[model samples]
Target: MQQSKFPKYIFDWFGGLVLLIGYIIGSVIVGFVGVAGKFIFRLDFMQKPWFLMLSNAIVFCLVIAAFDFLIVRPKTGKKLNFNFSPTNFYTYLLIFPMMLGMMFIGEFFTAQIPTTGPFFGDYYEFFENLMSGLTDDPVLMVITAVIMAPIFEEIIFRGIIQKGLMNKGVEPWKAILFSSLLFGLIHGNPWQFVGATLLGGVLGLVYYKTKSLLLPMLLHGFNNLCSTLLVTYTKNESFAQAFKIPEWEILIIGIVLFSLFCYLFMKKNKVHYSDI
Candidate 1:
C-alpha cells in the first residue's frame, strides 16, 4: 500500500464533499440541457425515471473516476486492486449467502428504528419511489445501480479511504471502523445509514481479508440487486410475505443461518490482507 499525503478523514470528508459538489454541478448542467431539449427540441424524456437515474449515475461515475485518477493517484500512487487475489471462488460462494443473512439481520434492526416522524417519512417516500418506478427501467437500472455504483463505491471506500488509512499506520480494525462509519454517513439518512454501515463493515472485512476490491464490489452489486428485486417485485411487504413464510420463523432462520455461516467462514478462511 502506498502511503497517502492525506489522512483517512481527509479522504472521507473532503473527497466526499468534492463528489457532492461535483454532483450538484453536474445536475445543474444536465438540468439546463434537459430544459433546452424540452423547450426547443420538444423532448420530454428528461422527466423519465431512467433518464434521471442514468444522469445521476453517469455524473457520479465521471466525478469519482476523474478525482481518483487525477487527484488521489497523483498523491498516493495507490494501485487500483480491481482483481480478486489471495482468495478464490469458495470464499465468494460463502460470502453471498452470508451477506443475505446479514441483510436479514440488518433489516430486522432497521425495522426497529423509530422512523415515525415527517423527516423519516420523506426518505421513506424516496425509497419507495426508487424501488417502484423512479428508477424502474430494468436495463438502465441494472446498468446504473448494479454496475456503475458498486464499481466506484468500492474503489473509493476500500481502495482509497480504508487502504490509505492502513497505509498511514492505523490499526486494521480502526481503519475499517472509521471507513465504515464514513460510508454510512455518506448515505445521509438513518434508513440507509444503518444498513449501509453494516454492509460497509462486511465489505471492509472482505477487502481487508483479501486485499482486493473486486470481491466487495461483486458483493455490493449483489446486495443492491437483491434490494431492487425485493422492492420492485414484492411491493413493500417484508421478505417473509414474499416467500409465504412466518415472520418469526424467517427471523429465527436468519439468525441461525447467519451464526452458522459466520462461524464456518471465520474458521475456514485465513486472511492475507496486503499481497497487492
Candidate 2:
C-alpha cells in the first residue's frame, strides 16, 4: 500500500465530526417525519411501524449518501465506485464463527456491563417494544433489518469513514478497529455494542482483504438476516419447544474451520490496494 502524506488524526477527527453531524441531521429528519405522520395521518405507527422505521432508514441513508457524494467527495476529490462482486461469498462463511465468538463474549460481559445513559431494565424494554413494532410485518422487518440497514450502514462506515481514515495515513488495522468501535457505539446500547463491534471488526477485515464494500455489506446483511430468523423462530411455540441441540461441539468445529479458511484466504490474496 502506498503511504499517505497527510496526518491521519486530522482525517480521523474530521470523519468523526462528519458522522456526528450526519447522524444529528438524520435523526432530526426522522423526528420530523414521525411527528408529521402522526399529526396528518392520525396514526401512531402501531399500525405500520415497519413503514415508519423503513422511512427513517431510507431518509438517513439518502442524507448520508448525498453528503458523501456532493460535499464530502468534492472536498476529498473522490468518486463513489461501489464494487459489489459476487466472488466474495466464501469470505462470509468464514465470518460466521467470528460473529458467534463475539456473541459468546457478549454473554460473558452481560453481567458485568454497566448500564450507561439508561437503566438496563428500561433499555431492554424500549428495545423490545421497538423490535416488536418492527417485527409486526415480517416482510418489512426483513427488508429493513436485513437488506437496507446493512447496505447503507456498510456504505457509510466501511466505504466512507474507513476509506477516509486510510486516506489520511492511518494504518489499515487501526482504521478498521476504531471504525468498528464507532460502529458499535452508534447503536446506542452497550449490550448490543459488544457483538456489533466484534462483527464490525470482521466486516472491516473483509473490506480490507477484498477491497470491496459489497462483500462486507452482504455479510452484514446475512448476519442481520440470521438474527432476524433466530428471533422469528424463537417466537414460535413449536420451534421454541423443540429439543434445541447444544452447539458447543459445533461451535468448536466452526472455530477450526473458520481459522483454516481465514488462513487460506489471507495467504491466497497478496495484492493490496493503494490508499486513497
lDDT of 1 by residue, 59-78 (tens): 76666665566556666575
**Best by lDDT, which number?**
1
Report lDDT (Cα) of residue 26, candidate 1.
77
Question: What residue pairs are clashing in model 1?
Answer: none
The 10-residue segment of model 1 with minimum total lDDT is: 3-12
**Candidates' RMSD to native:** 3.9, 4.9
User: What is the overall TM-score of model 2 with all chains considered together?
Assistant: 0.78
Report residue 28 deviation for candidate 2 (angstroms). 1.9
lDDT per residue, candidate 2, 93-173, as tens digits?
Answer: 555555555444443444356544568768877866767876667887788888888988897778777766876788999
The C-alpha stretches of model 2 lying farther than 4 A from their native spots are 1-11, 45-47, 69-71, 88-118, 236-254, 269-276
Q: How badly does each model clash, as a count of residue pairs?
A: 0, 0
TM-score, cand. 1: 0.80
Model 2: lDDT of residue 12:
58
Runs with alpha carbons beyond 4 Å of true place in candidate 1 = 1-17, 76-86, 114-119, 246-248, 271-275
* Shift in Å, residue 142, candidate 2: 0.6
